[model samples]
Target: MTVTFSYRSRQTWADPWDDYRALRDEDPVHEVGDGQFWVLSRFDDVFAAARDTATYSSANGLTTAPDDMAGFDEKARPIVMMDPPDHTAMRRLVSRPMTPRQVAPVEDLVREFVTDKLDAVADAGEADIVEALFKPLPSFLVAHYLGVPTEDRVLFDRWTERIVQATAESAAQDGPNQQAFLELFEYAGGLIERRKADPGDDLVSGLVQQGEDVASAMWIVGFIFTMITGGNDTVTGMLSGSAVLLDRHRDQRRLLIDDPTAIPNAVEELLRLTSPVQNLARTVTRDVTLHGTTIPAGKKVLLLFASANRDEREFGPTAGQLDVKRRIERIVALGYGAHHCLGASVARLQCRVALEELLGRFPDYSVDESTARFAAGWSTRRYEYLPLTTN
Candidate 1:
């Protein structure tokens, strides 16, 4: 079980499609590191594992949980950490507010927000997209949805990023987002207490009166934080990555400019290639063999989705090429099966609307590649800094 640290491994882990294509062609599952777990590289294997929670299991934590949590506590298991009846109940209760349809009314506000940010940029100058738009846009939106106060929005974003960064650090090492959870619980708990006394239209108020216990409502808040953690980075990544790719493929950029309908397809291809959340892991509840490799019970197995999306076996030759016309349905980017991203539809809607509005307002855009900053963390991959120029 020797792991090869190729010059390309750095890029592959950061941008993993190439390694996945090669692995899917050769051996789909390989033991890496100290043989702690097996890496699942093919699309089917990853998809099956994500969908079939009974055999593959979820308590192991998606991607990876902090080492401290595996020892366990009762509420330590988030909805993503459960299976069957419990998972179904929890996810159903909280996910309603985040659905694409539920979030539709806010779409116009989103377009305005994106346009205003784009307008702030000079015609041919540099600006950090992450700071200027990517980080704040979704952050503010989620805050607004949760009824987080105007003064507290920045606080909410910063605290959550710290938790995510800490989770990333743990992966490199040992974490829930516990601190953020507690702060939010305290806040949501207070709000719930207040809402119990006086209710409203916000999601939190609905949960307090008729939802599960406060703990259930608490996890709903946690669930939203998870959505924010799981989503915010990638949306920014796709926008930043698409902006860069469009700049590099000037011809494609021209095509998209000429036909606004092309923006949606371009967003899909961008998602397939630049998977922001790079890895997903499942714990084995029983013995299961994938492509002839056995995964033992209780051990964690990781799905390298960032690797699988471009696997030549799955996409055939030219799997690596970016085709805007490619249909991204069923790709591992939003995941598959029951636990697939609850926010997938909302994300796509937001992205489609965002890109269309962006291009409509300013037809041509370019990223200053030299100053581009790729986000670092084994748990996630995205652009932390992408400066842009528009015409």
Candidate 2:
């Protein structure tokens, strides 16, 4: 059967949400077009498929891996792609760094990183938040946390941009990024070996303590690239998106200024509503039925997490409202179940700290809509650059 990928043709940012909404009301699970795959847009359907690894597979790789990542598949050929026992075993190596007990101690580091980045722009008063603020926080933190030298921070920042190249122009413009990745990989591989010899008090040291060998060593390097790409770009998007949303919702901005405690929950609400990574693909290995549609194996299904976040069936009437107080757990934007984001806590902390400092330093910031840009891919959406001005 010839698969007619509707999502790819005549694309628009809203097309995914629009199609999902239409599916939820009319045919929640049906063939979208001739020879096309089935879509499951409702909350229960997407999560059920995501949780059930028996049918859906992450092995052929999540198609959302950006095109610019040169050896990304070979590099990412680690736990992120693994399903069962393999995924479980490898995930255990660095699990402690992300839990609450582990993360709390890093709060000071988070604040320090936030302070320094914000300080870079506090004097300018008018800087592109993506370039001046959002871009560096994770770049700095990722390098710092991974034991990469401070001097290499600039190189890390550039390589991450290339690996995350989402638009046609940026993709075309990533020749330098490709070269940088080769140099960075060799440099990082050597760094990984150095950590093996004399492990220190850093996250990479912890990986070494876990008996990380050459394979695990490679995974660690790949993880850094993946984490920076995923954690950095997504957080940057959320921060940028929140800046824009707050600009539109002046009253919401007031609420934040009045009560800074709302910031944490506000982060979750923003994460749910913004939905940076739109959908992830899973190819079926065995014949199975999902959301009332049968897959005869060897077909890919997109778990539209962005659509599932707004699943009216689960959220009731206020599903779409942006309520800072509202708790939005069970979001798949970070992936759900066993394969859920291992770095979720770090990502949350990054977003929280980044925004907190932004607000504290410049409680009065406005988004310049004319200068904002969005990631090009229909599958994984993020901000290209979010320009803001402080008044």
Best by lDDT: 2
Global lDDT of each candidate: 0.68, 0.71
By summed lDDT, the worst window of 10 consecutive residues in model 1 runs over: 1-10
Q: What is the lDDT of candidate 2?
A: 0.71
Cα TM-score of candidate 2: 0.87
Error of 1 at 4 (Å): 3.5
How many clashes would you count in candidate 2?
Answer: 0
* Candidate 1 root-mean-square deviation in Å: 3.5
lDDT of 1 by residue, 173-267 (tens): 22345566567557656666767777776666666666565446556555555655666766766666666777787777677778878877877
Cα RMSDs of all predictions? Answer: 3.5, 3.8
**Residue 220 displacement in candidate 2 (angstroms):** 3.4
TM-score for all models, in order of appearance: 0.87, 0.87
